[model samples]
Structures are given as structure tokens and as C-alpha cells.
Target: MHENEISQIVFDSGLKIHRNLGPGLLESAYEECLFYELSKTGLLIEKQKAMPLVYENVRLDIGYRLDLMVERKVIIDVKSCESLNDVHLAQVLTYLKLSGCRLGLLINFNTKLFKNGYKRILNGDVAL
Candidate 1:
């Protein structure tokens, strides 16, 4: 499946989770629920994936992990905050750059309406 398709599934799964659980839960709760929901979709997913930075020909294993990687194509960052901000957007972008992925979804589950917290960040060829 394409990255866009995988992204849509993730978004749908997130909505389902938010509707059932409501808000005020920890980010991990939503993450795990989303992970479980994603699992049933039959798509490949990696939770808390470690991401390293390679600079000056050195592979540095800094502490950075993608919240969830769907099909190894889309970087999904789950956030539970009063609102989604630039930092959250930058986070997903940084993950995309580090992982060499072009597409990502930033889903903040701390909103009255789930759609208001959804964002799609892209880099590389897709950015054009």
C-alpha cells in the first residue's frame, strides 16, 4: 500500500480510539490503543522505533524513537497536549528526515474534535 493509504488507515484508527476512550488519558494509552488498532488493520507497524543520526560519517544513536511507523513508510507521532503546536509539527518532520521517509502524520488526541488535531507533514520528493 502507498504511504498515503497507510496514513489514512492510521487516521481512521486514531479516530476510533479517541471516540471510544475520550480524552484525559495518557499519551501512551492512546499510543498503545492506536498500535493495537493498527495491528488489526494487517499493516506492518513498529512501535517506539529507535532513530539514529548519522553525521560526519558517524552513526550516532541519539535517543529518538518514532511513536509508530506504519508499513515503515509513514511516521506517526502521537501527542496528547492542550493543542498541537509547531514543536509537534517539527517533531514529525525531524523524524521523517532522520528515517528518510517522506510522509508523516501528527495526531494529537487532546482535542475536542479529533480532526482539529490531525496534521500531515511531508519532506523530500513529496514536498515538491
Candidate 2:
């Protein structure tokens, strides 16, 4: 599937999870639930996927990880913070660069409203 399609499923799944569980839970809880919800869609999903960093033509396992990678096209960075900030956006953007993904979802499940807690980040010249 395309990144946008995968992203829509992720948004729907996240909304359902936020509505059912509400907020104040740990990030891992929301991540696991989202993973479970997305799994039902038959889309390939990876949780806590390790990412290697390449510097100066040398590959290094620098402990970078994506919270969830959907269909290997979009990266989902799950967060449960007081608020989503620039750091969060930067993290997702960095992951997109490293993974060569065009889209990413930075979902922070710690707000009174789910919509206020999510952000869509695009890498480079992505169409959507």
C-alpha cells in the first residue's frame, strides 16, 4: 500500500485506541494497542524496529529505532508526552531520512483530545 493509505489506517487505529483507553497511559501501552489494531488490517507492521546509522561510509548500529513501521513505507513514532514538541517532530523527520520513508506520524497519546496530540511529518519532496 502507499504511504498515505498506511497513514490513514494508522490515524484511524490511533483514534480508536485513544478513545477506548483515554490518556495518561504509558507510550508503550498505546503503541502495543495500535500495533494490535493495525495488525488486524493485514498490513505489515514492525514494532521497535532497530535502525542503523551510516556515517562517513561506515555503518553503525547507533540504537535508533522506529516505534512502528507500517508496510515499510511510513514510520510511526508513538509518544505519550505532556505535549508534542519540536524534538518530537525532529525525531520523526530523522527517522524518515534514515529509513528513506516519505511520511511519518508522530502520535502523542497524552492529550484531552486525540487530534491535538498527533502530527503528520513529511520528508523532502513527498507528494502527500
Candidate 3:
């Protein structure tokens, strides 16, 4: 599936999860729920997938992990915090770069409104 299509499904799943379980939950809780919801759609998803970093032609297992990688095309960074900061955005962007994916979704489940908590991040200078 395309990244945008997968993203739409993710948004819908996130909304359903947020509505059913409101906020104040842990990130792992939301991630598990989201993973279950997405799994039902028959899409391939990797949870807590470890990522290796390469520096100066040397590969290092720096313990970077993606929260969820959907279909190997999009990365989903699950967050349940007071608010998403620049670090979160940078984290997703870094994942996209490392995975060579074009799109990423940063879903923060600790908000009064679900829509306000999600952000679509592009890998490069491409418009959203």
C-alpha cells in the first residue's frame, strides 16, 4: 500500500484507540493497541525494530529502534507525553533517513484531541 493510504489507516486507527481509551496511558499501551489495529488491516508492521547507525563507514549498533514500521515504506513513532517536542520530530526524521523511507507519522496520544497530537513528517524537502 502507498504511504498516504497507510497513513490514513493509521490516523483512523489512532482516532479509534484514542476515543476508546482517552489519554493518560503509557506509550507502550498505545503502541500495542495501534499495532493490533493495524495488523487487522493485513499490513506488515514491525514493532520495536532495532536500527543500526553507520558512521564513517563503520556500522554501529547504537540501539536505535523504530516504534512501528509499516510495510517498510512508512515509519510510525508512537508517543504519549505532555506534548511532542522538536526532539520527537527529529527522532522520526532520523528514522525516515535511516530506513530510507519517504514518510513518517508521529502520533502523540496524550492530547485532548487526537488530531492535534499527530504530525506527518516527510523524509526530505518534499511537501506534505
lDDT of candidates 1 onward, in order: 0.89, 0.92, 0.95
lDDT string for model 3 (1-128, tens) is: 77899999999999999999999999999999999999999999999999898889998998999999999998999999999999999999999888889999999999999999999999999664
- List, residue by residue over 105-125, the lDDT tens digit for candidate 1: 998899988998889889755
Clash number for candidate 3 = 0
If ranked by TM-score, best first, what sequence of candidates would result?
2, 3, 1
The C-alpha RMSD of each candidate to the native structure, in angstroms, is 1.3, 0.8, 1.0
Tens-place lDDT per residue, model 2, 6-95, is 878898999999999999999999999999999999999999999999999999998998999998899999999888888888899899
Worst 10 residues of 2 by lDDT: 1-10
After superposing candidate 3 on the true structure, give the runs of residues whose Cα lies further than 4 Å from its correct spot. none
After TM-score superposition, the amount by which residue 112's alpha carbon in candidate 3 deviates from its true location, in angstroms, is 0.6
TM-score of each: 0.95, 0.97, 0.96
Worst 10 residues of 3 by lDDT: 119-128
Model 2 stretches with alpha carbons more than 4 Å out:
none
Q: Model 1 compared with the native: what TM-score?
A: 0.95
Q: Who is ahead in TM-score, 1 or 2?
A: 2
